[model samples]
Target: MLRPAASSSSGRRRRSARSRHAPPQRSAVVPSGAPRPPQRLPAAADADGADARPAALSVRPPGPCSPRWAGSGRGYANEPRRARPSQRLPPQGGRGPRGWQRACARACARAPCLGQHQPFAACRGRKRKKERERVFSLPAGGRARWLVLPGSEMAGLTAMEKKLAEYKCNTNEAIQLKLVRFPEDLEDDNTTFNPEYSHQVFGDDEVAFGYKGLKILLYYIAGNLSTLFRIEYTSKVNEKFDCVEADDVESKIREIIPPGFCTNTDDFVSLLEKEVNFKPFGMLLHTYSVHNEEAGEDITYQIYKADMTCPGFREYHERLQTFLMWFIETASFIDVDDERWNYFLVFEKYNKDGATLFATVGYMTVYNYYVYPDKTRPRVSQMLILPPFQGEGHGAQLLETVHRYYMSSPTVLDITAEDPSENYIKLRDFVLVKLCQDMLCFSPGNLMQGFSQEMVMEAQQKLKINKQHTRRVYEILRLRATDMGDAEQSRSYRLDVKRRLIGPYKKKQRELAKMRRCLRPEELTNQLNQIDLNMQHEQLEESFQQLVSDYRRVLERLAQA
Candidate 1:
């Protein structure tokens, strides 16, 4: 009853079951020490018995370049947190849950500073000491307290201990929120192209409406300065840039930005809407456009092989993965820190009036597994072409490009996709068929000879295709080789595929017989008889028909190719 998933939440877990290999890179980062302390949110309740309004979603300032205030107890500007208890009361009316949480968070931000004295210089140089101070800090409004708390005093408890205390105290009542602007308010055709905005606002599968951009930059704080982490931009445009100066950065970003952003509006929220460009920094991946006569237009696209070692890979992936939640059913983000996982990004290039623009087409993440003594196998984990780009052969191009990338690696054993969706299967079928057609071993004469070790060997050796996938290719190719006009040949091909489909049902029957240990032969026979054999046969036929239909489609594409 389990259909092949278009995307899998546990792609790595499935790969782990099949291959045992230490990832070339660490799957996760373990902090150097026992662990940092956890922050606590102060509790607050609206004095008025009315519902609280949801506050604006908060934006998590980039960690490295986070805005910091430098002043002791109350010296810093404290608009939200400086409110006295009397002022904290909901202005004679009820507030929303979001407002309530914000109030509690603001209160928590000022709690540590109440009548406390500490010198910031004492904890300035110590990494662990600074961490302790930051850990207890409220993610919001608490920036003011960073200047007052003694880092040493903050290192009193481990993260787990603090978490336990927070759990027992029920911290859910004071949720920390981030600033986010919903795009719903924008005119239907008004476009925003900032990758960071997309990250903060959209779910993975939720495509950005009227939004398109290829360049995603990530930045972090280093030595109290905002340092560029990496810049992932499409090279298809062939534009020049410099980000060293703040003004230069802004100017370069604005040049590529589409118009009608409402940037000049006086509304603070509209101002908060970042011009859809500035992104965290990362390496620039180039994209190429392929001319396809069949599609009737030239398709400009590129596949960037993203590496884990690349700066800002993690941040870029964090923003990029928002697409998974919105597009891929059961889609899960891959562990980018894992050296074994490889990310391939596809982008479409277009000219927007005067400027060259790029929009994300789709992407795939693959995990490379050690096959044994020397060879490696790359398994496609999750694949998604955004809904706008689907059915345009972009998926096939992405998959083939990945296959070609790994084909040159002598250590690669074979290429496989993990729990492929039906659409993915069809795409794979077409790509593999097109690839193998030129190989003499897959000629019609050899294919009609039936499945053989030669087909599997040739596929694995030449194309880095796995044996299981090779067998499937052989079946489809054989069907192509068989003429339906010959009844015997068609019947054999049907049975060959049906036997594979009926395997699980046959196994279930055997398992059922083994479970009838307490039943008499007559009773067991009755139980077996009650099982709907005709229905099972019908299911098999249906599956067979559907599969044949899919195979025919692949063959038709192959014929065209």
Candidate 2:
């Protein structure tokens, strides 16, 4: 069209323009009949010849919907268009807008075209995830969408709840204790029992936080008290969460039970076979018989007094005292090597094939504390009747047997208890009342009079009862003699007990008068306000009623005896 554009130069000019706009060409040869690879376009340049956008946003291959690929016969135009990273809409139910953005960002990172476009497959997956979330989500200010589920769906919800429930366990319920006599007892469901408490082993809450479906079975052979320790659970806390820790129940139990307990069931069962050779430790103190209603026969029991010097007895004792941790509150191990410590053990004497087999029924510990003027006070420390043997009068039998054993010693000034529990006190009341009822000083006629020094002297000299206990015995006997139906006798009895009950109040009144002399007027008034006389009177009456009720039970039992 004009001097006919320089033919060779025209071709060169067009090629130069294509080089500026298109992706770099590969120098490698292509196999014949193979289509060339798709090329991307470079971003337009500014007047200064610098790229218009960052490299990550500049390079973009032709999409399937693009017109440039339609005539290439590649069938790209027939396919669906992929969304650009920035142009994509978040999926309907996805992790909201944020999740879609995250998906898009991840897709872009893995794109062959750098970050220029998100792939179709990745976008589709994100859309499906969003739809799922939307379907499960509750509407704004509406009830939970899952509430109207069918039975099967409800069961699914329960499974979810159960899954969460496994993380927390009531340790008391989770731990099962059994006194295994036969090998079959281990497998019997009837033989299993739970602990009354686990706060001593766990913490105050008594919860094992990091476990699911926890089952800790502790089995001990009925005879010789050999242990079989085992623990089981569906899942542990560490398996689910990285930050939390589960209770180390085995270690806690180990701290209580001595070394040499069997962890294997076979080992424990083998140990039970040797129990026929197990005899009562120490010297035999007494033998008694009890009627077993379940077995329809009489079973003989033996009591033994053991010390650390007895062969194998020290180790046996270590195994025996471990029961205290499970049953006794505020339980602690004692120094068995101490000479003053005395152990009284009870065993069931059973004959198996003409050989006597002794099974542990219970035990009591007494520490002889030195009293002034060469006398010794034997203090009852810990007493426990194995659960299987409890409620069968073994406790009463063991207690009375121990009392008789101490009564013979001249050095024993009196029998006492260290921080006796309510149950022990009740047992002691019954035993002492039974023992004193036969004495002349505790006769009904003498009891009607009042508590006397004669009662104290006779009880101490004959039974080694302490002065405080002797007074308590007097009251119990007095209540027994009093006729509550007669107003005069009832009034007298009430007034008598009230006088003793009011002792602390009287002492407090004296202290208050002394305080008036020293404390300022405001301080004295504050103290007086705290001591409400009306409340004290009401409490006194309540306490007197309680004491009379307790005394009546003892009398009833005494009558039975």
Candidate 3:
């Protein structure tokens, strides 16, 4: 009944449905777009020699003193694009679709200039000129700017986009791509953390592994700048700072990093400076560590055995939990721009089976950015997973994870998705069934027209009537515009036309709520009593409504006369 995905390379359209993973924590950026939440040095780190301790993770907040290149792009560096056609031969023995696409992409295209991106790269400036031909022509090297952010930081992305509200040209807010990082090597317990000797790399937020930790990578891209694209890794959650752990971290670094392999930051930086690298102006590399107290001590993945009850760790833990859960699972992403971000999610497991696109849900402008543009963060558009792990309810779990870290506000989180042809909207319904409390309303659909016959006929008739009405209104307005002397009279005539069109419908609706709620019982005695009450109330209010309606009629009639 099916061909194995591993061997099937028959031009199948492998689509990955968006699978949002749960964030370990939540970061609520209140709408004041307040300056990067002030950084208070961790109290645990306040002890002796704390200032001298290595920074496990550094905060790159938006400030006047922030990194100058934080948001300003370096354009497309010409290394990959500047290659000659001879480079397209792929050293004579390259294989696979990635290799093919790479060669094709690099070869036939008009290369862009190195060092800077074209200023007119799809023109966002207000000084519109008649130069339409240039937009189509690729500046010598055809490559354009690419945004690379971690797949999971949808909240931070959203916060950054809000800050860009005033910038009109930042239309490419949400970018889509299959962000595949296939490092040439890999790292593990047997290996050490050496950035210099690395061949390949795979990174999920701040935590990344180098070529010594070999793994296949294939995924999509969206509107994000993968900034933490490095070998050094960190996963921050709730933890009391520990010098011992830092030392252990350093020791571990000693093993993975072989001698003569780049040992220092400069060596690590060079790994990213390779010719075929996707570099964005900024990157928000976020990884979360939840304190699994119940799991007990001596675990390999454990971050701490210390008390989670401490205010700093516990409070920040809660904040992070909420941020991770809410942003990916529940946060509303409204892509105001036409930017459709590409995405790729590499699961812990890679099945040869294609990604079963379980659902395609969407949220409208139910939410806005809370931060201002000067802060300069990549606006998030999606929180999605990769192709290999699509059907196993991971998407829904991801949504729930987001809800856990949600920042409270009024938002309409709607999902628009399609299921397998045989199981249309089934998975979506399953999620809705589970998230009943949090869900607003959903519209399950099929590729069919469901209009009732009566509605169809009525709509057709209304279309003609609407056309006539529009013509009449436009003509009357045009006449009034041309003849100011009769403007007042024409205005009255306009009002008459409007009332004739909508007055009865409005009046009927106003009467319906009262009529529906004030019903009489069917029992004889009860009916009599209800009728008497209804009669009395109706008598008391009948004249009031009639008089008001009549007064309005008189006013209109008088104006016209």
TM-score of 2: 0.71
Backbone clashes under 3 angstroms, per model: 35, 3, 79
lDDT per residue as tens, model 1, 57-83: 222222332122222222221111222
Better of 1 and 3 by lDDT: 1
Q: What is the C-alpha lDDT of each candidate?
A: 0.50, 0.66, 0.25
Give the local distance difference test score of model 1.
0.50
Q: What is candidate 2's lDDT per residue for 97-190, written digit by digit as tens? A: 3322232222222222322232222222222222121111111211111112223323443433344345778888988888776778889988
- lDDT for model 2, on a 0 to 1 scale? 0.66
TM-score winner between candidates 1 and 3: 1
Q: For residues 350-424, what per-residue lDDT tens digits would candidate 3 score against the true structure?
A: 111343111111111112223353321122234433222234344444443333223221231222221222122
Candidate achieving higher lDDT, 1 or 2: 2
Candidate 1 ranges beyond 4 A from true positions: 1-297, 352-357, 512-519
